[model samples]
Target: MQRPKPAVIDRATALRYMGAAGWQPDAAATALLDKAEALVLDAATPRAALRLLPRSALPTEGQGNDLRRHLEGCSHLLLMAATLGGELDKLLRRLELSDIALATAADAMASVLLEQVCDALEAEQRTYFLQQRGLYLTGRYAPGYGDCPLALNDELCLAIDTVRGCGLAVTEQHLLSPRKSTTAILGAADHPVTGYRAGCATCHLQKKCAYRKRGITCADS
Candidate 1:
């Protein structure tokens, strides 16, 4: 595991996460977001871990058709976990006690940072496998997408040793702890992969997403 360099958080993405994407921020709101962004950047400590396993090695009991289809034509799966660490969690909690609005901004910024970290990890592995073994990676699919069971997070956590490697934890409720972390699965194939999308089309929350309600998509930001 290697520490990823800090990334500049995208303001639009952060606003989208906060469900305030289209709303114009007043001076007070702008100041609040500025403060929260600074705190999130200061507190964040990015870390990531990845593990590659043969597709057949994964247990089959709970895998859904959607996931199976997503990995079709692939011989191996790449499991990844990434986080902004627990210090960001502590900062968010403290802000929650004093200013809910600021806390909300911080949470959104943290989410963006975590996503950036995951993207970087995925790109890193994609290049590694391509150059080292002539394999290409399918777009990542995570637990809780479509019929993919949320319970799979536990298995994923253990498979990748996310707890010891990156300090990422999976709760009994299937949530990732440090409160700002993510896990994903990517398939490696002998040929180039396609037909995967990360926007509203593939998201399980499509019908209820705040972005959709605003006539936009997460990818828009």
Candidate 2:
């Protein structure tokens, strides 16, 4: 079932995503943001899927205990995919400096907007599962986190019918094309939500991360 679309984008949240991507914007960056936001409106489209997947579908071995621990109490998996349409890539096809920066900023904004949309969708699911049916949610665990190989993306995209559902595909390298899209797994828990907080350790930028010094979390984006 579909939920209400999220409200207009939040500048702070978009900045947070840019911060996670390691681009501290100056005035020029902020200016890029306006154009980027317009591009998001014109060029991006969000897609997602929700299902009560059996835990067996998730690889419980390897990938460290962090992911397994997170899903320990859950009975099902929640798979979702959201993407900015291919228009952004078309916008980036030109090999020019100006286009490069615009493509980069717009890509960052797409990440934030996609997450914002999914967060809203996740919240709606949590409300229904918790208040109406008594369940909780684990934070989303995308492939490439910890020891979970990116190759698993193939399995996930296939399971969720991402190509048909959202025009998403996983390359042989396990990368999702259109570059600004993501697929993730969340667990359906039986107790109150706990033990998951966005932190430097779990972030994609944890390697030589500046945010770690400032006590920031990548997932905040």
Candidate 3:
């Protein structure tokens, strides 16, 4: 399959996600975004591993209603991710310091970089899938949502090899390393997506989400 062109990270969008995470882009965050971009560009490849299997093959059993709904409305599901390793690991380690003051800068930088990378990946994936037919991206729906089990991360990792190339690894406790990486299922719909919301505003769990309390809105147009 042909790979979509990389999405340019507009400064506005970069700042939006960073701000949502309570991160202001300082010199450190700019550095992290640059480094993360290099890493993602070098490691990204067109993953044909995502076969359009029945939603039943999603590794979740109780997804009958949700899967049925998604299938009826979606044209394809796009899965894109990379393993996090090397420089990325070192970057994350630096951000994991116990001292609040010491780690704040690093944490902000990591947050900005992660969101930028995911946004770029999502844009590219959406374009590629959309070119194939009457499909448009509804939005990315990750595991651990309403009924989507976190256990499905195992299947996601196996299918995408997110650990090998991108250096992203999940812990025994099922937490993704780097604390910045993500695995999401992007549903392709026949109808056009008119809105461009990102963080908490577009999130279905916003009302009850702790992240929303921090003043994060999904208004990333």
Please report the candidate that would top TM-score against the real structure: 1
Across residues 88-198, which tens digit of lDDT does each residue of candidate 2 receive?
Answer: 566555423468777766766666777777778777777887788677878777877754567878888888888877778889899997777788888876776553443
| Residue-by-residue lDDT tens digits, candidate 3, 94-162 | 545643433443444445445555666667667776787656775655665544556667787666666
How many residue pairs clash in all the candidates, one count each? 0, 0, 8
Task: Name the regions of candidate 3 deviating beyond 4 angstroms.
Answer: 1-54, 60-72, 83-86, 95-102, 189-209, 212-221
lDDT of 1 by residue, 1-221 (tens): 65665556877878877766677888998898888888998998988888889987666345776787788788888888888888888999999999998898989888887887777777778899999999999987888876678889998999889989999999989999988888888988989975244445656798898767878775665
The CA lDDT of each predicted structure is 0.82, 0.69, 0.53
Candidate 1 vs candidate 2, lDDT winner: 1
TM-score of each: 0.88, 0.79, 0.60
Best by lDDT: 1
Q: Extract clashing residue pairs from model 1.
A: none
List ranges where model 1 is wrong by over 4 Å.
22-26, 195-207, 215-221
Return the TM-score for candidate 3, rounded to 2 decimals.
0.60
